[model samples]
Target: MVAIIKTGHSIRAMLNYNENKIKQGKAECIGQGNFPVDADRLTYIMKLNRLEKQCKLNENVKRNTVHISLNFDPSEASLPKEKLLEIAGSYMEKIGFGDQPYLIYKHNDAGHPHIHITTINVQENGKRIVMHNIGKDKSEPARKEIEQAFNLVKAEHQKKKEFKPEPVSVRVQYGKTETKNAIENGLNFVVNNYKFTSLPELNAVLKLYNIEADKGNENSRVAKHSGLLYHALNGKGTRVGVPIKASRFHDKPTLKKLEKKFVANEIKRQTDKSRIKNAIDNVLLRNNIIILPQLVKQLKKEGIDTVLRQNAKGLVYGATFVDHKTKSVFNGSGIGKEYSAKELRDKCGANLEKLKGEFQKAYSRDDLLNMIKEDRGLLSIDDITKIVDLLSKTESTFDYLNKDFLKQRRRKRHRRGN
Candidate 1:
């Protein structure tokens, strides 16, 4: 069972969308409880007719729509419509949907049961209301409540639970030496072979009679049959994990479990990235490399410009450069093959050169050079070699082999061996 609240769309648009879902008939309507007894049902009937007068009756109440859907394997015993309506009413009362105008219409046109609901966001007096947040709030609790009320064991425990229907065991008799009377009894034995929890178990039973079980197709109706999922448990037993197509399975717990797994993995990924960032920051600080503030100041001093913009890659730091000859808006990257701040500034000619000179005069070159040297010295000869090799490969130039590097490697190797 899942409850979804959607806002920011007109009532008519919402009605049409729900009407399409209802026409599929995958789920049954459970009736509304918020308004006068027949008022809720009246809206559902009226919405189906697309009657303008029916919708206008409650238009001034500032409506917001909520749809509640329940999905179960259809092969199992279905809850009676009267019982389903009772369940819906109890659920609404428990969740506090308020005694306002709301309708519950079951949709069975699809592959499963999804209930559509329309309600006023405010009470008859027109005060704003807070609704379910779905993943962030409601689904998990609702699932637990339903499982308890229905006396169905959690899906994980399906293997240990008994079947809901009477126990059926099967026995196989090989060879036909037994009389025709024995053959009828053997057939009875095979039909009672419904206890198995998995498809393989069910297949084993079918093999005895020389009748091969039809393996359902990818998109075929038989393939998506809900009964296969519920087959794990017979008499309201635990539900073994069964593959259900998106169209058939909509249990709240299943949805929450999926969301929980997704959120947990995402959180771990974000934490790992944070740790990586922290490690990089520590290395940069220890090596005295130019920090972000220093890099920004350097660009500003060099007369490099920047702007904020949104692109296909999302919100990003961007910049523009006017072509010197055409004076047209040219992106910073187009000013040169590489769009580094220094390269962009260089394209502005003498004024940029003068600015660079002024910037250089304002900072101590000795200090910046010392920082770079310190950072370089902090790395081992092997690390430095790897870095140089990477840069050489990228540039297609072996100019990275300076005399200082050869001396360091030779001295380091000698020191290691000694």
Candidate 2:
């Protein structure tokens, strides 16, 4: 089992997120304890309120909410609720939250069977449970003990570590089955198939499929650094390893060669828009697909990758479709305003009402646990336990999972979105 804990300020938002999913019938309120009404929303709110009310005695505790998810392997599916609760209780006791009131919510919306716990950090005595070094000092030890006691699959044994992009695996199966040949396959398919007026715009399409085109920084010391290269990317789109120079590819897709294609593609894509639009229309016409992930899967069958750009809050406001087979890039609005994020989301919302339970299978626990086995470089408990000393001082709630990645980018003079 893997545990991720976060400290936040709102009880309502966290509870509402899970409750909304439950109301949608995507999840269920499987079990609850230590509250007046165990099955209703009040069970969660009243307990959390009690914590906050007590914390008022302390006066300085601004952050009161604690959210944690316990994810188990697929093999552990059908794990009884009684056992799950026992594990949760043991975990709380080990982590110093045994006496604090909390609610456990089982979330099935993802590809794994997991439970969420929401509680406050403050005790009724108006004392704050020091969260310092909890992840390493307390939670880590508790997780291993729980796993051994339950005989659950250890994290290290989960899956291979390859970065397989979810909902878009169809692209690789169709062409470029080999990792080394992806450049030739993606470019041969894209260059002859799609249209783009610039390299950066083309890369937006390339980034979706893990084939990146690059020219070394202006002052790199390596000889022949001026040449363009192609690289593979991890799940996060960060480049990995040595790159294959543009000259090595059969088509010699160098910067100069691609610039020439850019002008021609502009004219070519103009004629191809109607054909491409029809393809997208055909998919949306189907009743089986809806929501973002399902829509991405259906489109991938035809070699299209739908990349949505969202703000920090996870609301997708813009989208891009990189057509690998035809090598075409179209903004949702560019394809047709009907394909824009707003329109698609609206359409998806309607279709979701009609989609059955099967469409959600892609997120099944088996599918999620399968990735862990494929997740190479996954750290084992033995490996983790070896690092006893710290490179920094005591790790607090902030060290638990507080990270802010700056998504910096230079504004493009040419608009990629319509």
RMSD of each: 23.5, 29.9
Q: In candidate 1, residue 413 scores what lDDT?
A: 100
Best by lDDT: 2
lDDT of 2 at 403: 38
TM-score, each model? 0.33, 0.41
**Candidate 2, lDDT over the whole model:** 0.63
lDDT per residue for candidate 2 within 1-418, as digits (tens), equals: 8887877666666676567657756566665545556655565456556556765766677777788878787667788988888888888888988887777777664445778887778787788888778899998999999889888887667641111222222233322324545555455445544587766667777776677777776665322444577777766776766777776654457777778878887777776566557767887677454455556667778777777765544456676777655557777788788888778766665543332233233233343233234421222232222122211212331233323321122223234432
Best by TM-score: 2
Worst ten-residue run, lDDT, model 1?
Answer: 321-330
**Model 2 CA deviation exceeding 4 Å by range:** 40-48, 160-418
